[model samples]
Target: MVSSAGFPDFTRVVSKTIHAVVNVKNFSKKYSNQFDPFDFFFGFPDDFGNNRERKPQRNDIPGLHGSGVILSPDGYIVTNNHVIKDAEKIEITLNDQRTYKAKLIGTDPSTDIALLKINEKNLPFIYFSDSNKVQVGEWVLAIGNPFDLNSTVTAGIISAKNRSLGILRGETQSSIESFFQTDAAVNPGNSGGALINTNGELIGINTAISSASGNFIGYSFAAPSNLVAKVIQDIKKYGTVQRAYLGVKGIDLSKTEYLKVYNQETHQNIKSQQGFLIGEVFEKSGADDAGLKKGDIIKSIDGKPIQNIADLSFIVGTKHPGDKIRVIIIRNKQKKIFNVILKDLQGRKKIRTKEEITPSELLGAVFDPLSKESKKDLGIDYGIKIKEIRTGRLSAIGLEEGDIILSINGIKMKNPNDVNKVLKKYSGDVTIKSIKENGQVYIAGFEMN
Candidate 1:
């Protein structure tokens, strides 16, 4: 007799989710043609000449295989960015061994979500759940193809949320992190898979795991479906994800104890407390244009208390460019309200395309204007010497303070404006050739996100 005093049965839910999961196999081929004198003289088994009665054997190149969930019945699927990154070919195999070639629609490296399309109709798909309502310790399932071991499913509860592992992708780092942490056994081949609730609704996308030997070590992270949905919608409509930016630069409030000495030295009477303190404001930026000055403490955004840098980032990220909102700040022990119009980090009213790189957008190292003294010290005629590395794209790439940028992609950069112009013309990877004071040349590559 079957026992009736058990928890709710979830077998049917797992069965339905399994039908929507598919195994992705990426294929590639490499051919080598070279003349070997020793082999020709010794009578080799295979001939290298084109006229010979032999053909090159087909080489199977196994790429980073993973899993994907069918998002729609018309064959729209969702997967991870790391799974199909740099893949020359993508093949999707169903549970029935039926396979088809998939086309890449879009990818967001910051959240590690990718959209793929295939030519099919009426396919089984899964629905997304309200990830915001999912509580920690709730039952969830991680479905994927681990180690090529077809369609494996592991069950666990949510461990934590809003995790920052410092995983970066090129020049774009995810400032909005509300990850659903779980102890699911996610592995290499399971990168682009689904994390679902007991109701079979997709809540998160399995992305990474914390392991020492490349195996599961009781820690895994997933991109929340809320963030995933936004990135997918943006990529599908505009071919890229657009992010809203706050104009002020500030350190995390939790580290105020260690920064008291520096803060006191910079501004007298400005107490180092728990909140985002404005360090520097860009000229004519959204915050600057709204009369926000340095040394002001950001108390909250739209009535929500500002906790740290990430908290402010998350609140700002939810808004779009040109959206107006009220910001509460504490300046000199006085509470003041300011109405600020949000803008993209570049102080632009809208998101820019591939051909727009302004001086403010080139956030990285600060360059000193061309002067006779600077030119004599750096031994460069038509280049700007790096003065201070503030905050921006270059600082994330390990650009030091004394590194002098001679040219960008072979175009001589005379000043910061010239460097921005050269960078704006190119859309993909841009190379920077820098020279040190002691004459050591190093190459750095920057990719636009």
Candidate 2:
């Protein structure tokens, strides 16, 4: 409902979605700071690990009072990954004030969506709207528990779409950042709220805001319901996201960037420079097999025009490995179309379900082969550095971020991919030879129970 001045009347929409929205509280006991204040300032031996559950010296405890949306009538809910991350306890408060301890079903940190389950049944839920059909300037109502106040509704229009804010890029190697931009007043407690349309359908999940004061300052972002819908299904099925990869490194281009390129080059004449420019193609990649090459410009995919990297990510992130997509690109000033099959980060054309794999088989560490310079410096010819420790069962078992893996079960690791291949085929007890940054070497052992 809209008035003459364009401000929407969100009466019925609020009534439909308010019950579905929940207030999520993530409680945490005080933890000793991981780094010693004096040591951190003076560069000495520090408290390297966070010892949580210790009695606090003061009363400053961390708490997360966020929001969530019920996705089904049987107590399934959706929220942001950061909301419940590392939470010792998750307490969900319904509209009727009934509280339940939420069970973490799964989480995709790249997309920032988490699925939670409660024992309650016959709960009110909201259906997802076709976010691709959502247009700019369409009226939207954000319903949540802002500032810990329940059932708050604010009306605004969809300010933009396919917004790439670069918030999720550092979270993973394959982060998706296509967000729906809106002007709704969102604050600290609105992290996982519902963004609904005029018909009261959930179009997006209010996740972030572009603000300097840590509060809503007219600009906010949400995970589109279309991507959310796909991720939720993957989480429920595979216990993780089946992120498909096109396997091409590229640069998003504009006319301004095209002009800069044209001025720098002393070669043949170039034109039509408003698309993604493929800079490199990895070996044994989907792009390589699809006949894509460097210097090619991707124009569209599956009849949809791609404006930038965010658009490309949104298109590919919704798909599974082995799914074929038609890619259109311009090569040598000529338009060409090729059918390309997507693959996962493991270079597998097929994704193995969670039930078919053990928790230890899933190595959650991103790795980089030790460089020649590094190998020469360290006096080691076979090793890989743990670049980032992603969330998994392995990470929980004391795997620090900077640990360099040398071997597993006496099999020397030569590169980043060597460990995964070893883990994929091996079974039973898991043992790893690793070296710390302080030149201390140790063996980490665990089982597949």
**294-399: candidate 1 lDDT, tens digit per residue:** 8788988888777666557656766667877789998888999999988875566776653443543444456766677867866778776678653344443335
The best candidate by TM-score is 2
Deviation in angstroms for 4 in model 1? 5.0
lDDT of 2 by residue, 190-278 (tens): 88899999999999999887664556778888999999999999877876677788999767775466545754773634554557888
Shift in Å, residue 17, candidate 1: 1.8
Q: State candidate 2's TM-score.
A: 0.76
Instruction: Give the number of the best model, judged by lDDT.
Output: 2
lDDT of 2 at 33: 33
Where does the lowest 10-residue lDDT sum fall in candidate 2?
Answer: 35-44
Model 1 residue runs over 4 Å out of place are 1-8, 28-60, 169-176, 255-275, 303-305, 333-335, 351-449
